[model samples]
Target: MISRSSQTAAIAFAVLILLLSASIGNAYEDVGVSISIKGTRSYKLKKEAQLLAKKQAIISYLKRVNPSAVGKSCAKQLVNDRAALIKRITTQEISQVGDYMEGSYLVRIDDEKLNYMLEELGCGAQNGATDVTILIMEEPPTKANISMILNPEDSTGVRKLRGLGPFAVFYTSYQRSIRDTIISKANKEGLKLTRLDTFDEFQKMRMSNDDPLVGVYFDDESEDFVINKRLLKVVRTRFAAQNTIVLYYRIESLYFDQVTRELNAAIAISLYDLNSGETKSVGSQDFMVIVPKGQSSVAIRDGLAEVASNAASLLMNQAKKQIRRMASIAQVHAQKKGTLPVTVTVHLKSKRTMYNVKKNLKPSMIRHSEIKGDSLILKLTKGIQADDFVYGELLGVLEGMGIKIPENNINLNGQEVIIQQ
Candidate 1:
């Protein structure tokens, strides 16, 4: 028979071991893994990195919880088959915890959900060890705000002017300096700048484009006293139906003020939305140099630079207001229905037609889309009964890309829209 003192000591030791095991299991419940990958700063790249980080974190958690099942061999296999594994896993709940550091990201995965996924993939623990719960905490995904700046090319062409009219044109001499300043300011304000020479380039760039809450087009060329009605009409027809909010700026006049005996410069500013197809004047301000009567040309140039800076500041403030309004609309829509599905069917002409179409649509707006030979079935996210906005935007994009869709060939049935070339 065992001695009573010995029995008590054995029980105490067993209890302590159990307690330690519980503590260890609890420690492995939540896991955070840091991932560093070199890639361009883009929505697609960030999303891919996020998925990869999540996969790494989940694998790490699995290894900690069940070393035997998720050992070196399993880890190697998971890494090799990550592309397939990523499709099976859902990351709607998983959150990226911090800002990307030197292209590195911290990803947190819920232990329970991860284990479930692993088991579903036939990579569960050998002995059904299930005591891990450590998960990285992260803020929920929120709506994104974006802004863009467009720079006009010096050379002119039918395609070029077609792409850049109504927006201010840049003077060849100071275009680079002004562009650099705008970029710097936009960077400080967390805005995205799309540097393009022409609207044709803009169309090509739009395929994988970010949705801009505000678009500021810089045109610094001196405007003619008489507006060209024919040119303006053509521009209106081409770019009038865009859904983006755009601010256009141009130098109206620059001359020596005879009465004030000073150099005077005026810039015309306008704000318009392609959605509404109207260009409303934002403001026109004159900058004057009232110092010495005989100022050097350099002094006049300096004065112009100052005026340009002031115009940029005013434009940015107006852009912010537009962004706020857009945000409010989005918030209201989100409250009503977080997302509504709209199906789009497009007739295909060539093999690359669908490819081009996919490139132009915003990725965030697309919930799911599939191309079936000559036809594309696109499921988009938007507000309920907002088909007009969707169809109008699509029409504008299609028109910009030189794709023709006859009015009679277009059809809308409830949430589904069909367009034939």
Candidate 2:
């Protein structure tokens, strides 16, 4: 022990052990995996196949350095942080088979991240629940970019009703109904329903589409991440789990015939493969109603509201299968990439307020007329009943916005309510 040569030999042995440990800590292995998923022609199949390959590869990598973590209750944790794990994964030799869209892939996961994934799983810390937030798109879609991504049909005035406002009573009630059903269904699926804290901000930016049939879609890969990164940035800032899911929905279109008293409407929902910024799936359903020939307008209105609202919920049930599958893919891809219009009467301000009056006053007024300043011509079908309904609605809107007008200042007419400036 006292000799210099002996001391040097001991020191060398210690350094070698340190080097070996470091090497061990950084050990990784490439995995060859084959998978075939059943689906129509869609990138969704490819994405699913890749996730399977990566999962196999991750397990394979852990088998080499940390065999103890090979099997465990790691699923919950995986669902939550799969995005970061996905970022650490690499794929190659991807080949596709016919209509099945089957594929085999060579997959690899980063050593450090692999260890982290396993460690987190082993600790049982992550609840592994996916956070799901649901939002209804704002009508008229504040931004021009929305039309750029929406299908041509979605962009048509017949579908979008651009420059027109939807009836708040009709749409918001349907939205609330759908929202409640979505939550109840999601709860059954065991997903952790966390708030999509950034969604409101996202809507304000108008990067999303209001068309229920469209939802939010990005055709270009670059733009996908650009939009996703905004959400991810919020996730990071708020320390949200990486795999939060958002569902965007809206009433696609609705029509009513005054003479026949028949109603027809459709609603749609769209989901995306967030990492790639591509549409994963879109689901829509139509509902129709024939109001009883002699029913009061109030009864017809209430019945229509109930039918539209309940139809959207029923459609959610019909689309539940697709939604669940999309949510699953959403979970897998989530780890891969890393992560609002209220028309309130503003003191009954401009001629613009007439849009609200017509939409709220008489349903036909909204659909058939291009309302202009102080020039409303009441249809013979709309009478005292319509005026009472519209007047009450106008008062509610003003009060809702925290706006007040003394009766003395309110110059109310049969179809107009203008506040004195």
- The best candidate by TM-score is 2
**Model 2 Cα shift for residue 127 (angstroms):** 6.0
lDDT of 2 by residue, 268-302 (tens): 66654333344534566666555434444444444
Off by over 4 Å in 2: 1-170, 188-241, 273-275, 330-421
Error of 2 at 246 (Å): 2.3
Q: Estimate each model's TM-score.
A: 0.33, 0.34
Q: Please count the clashing residue pairs in each candidate, in the order shown.
A: 11, 3
Which parts of model 1 are misplaced by more than 4 Å?
1-170, 174-187, 198-243, 258-261, 276-281, 291-295, 330-338, 342-421
Which tens-of-lDDT digit does each residue in 153-264 have in candidate 1? 3224433333223222323323334344444443333333334333442343221133111122222253222333333333333322112334455555544433454444
Displacement of the residue 389 alpha carbon in candidate 1, Å: 21
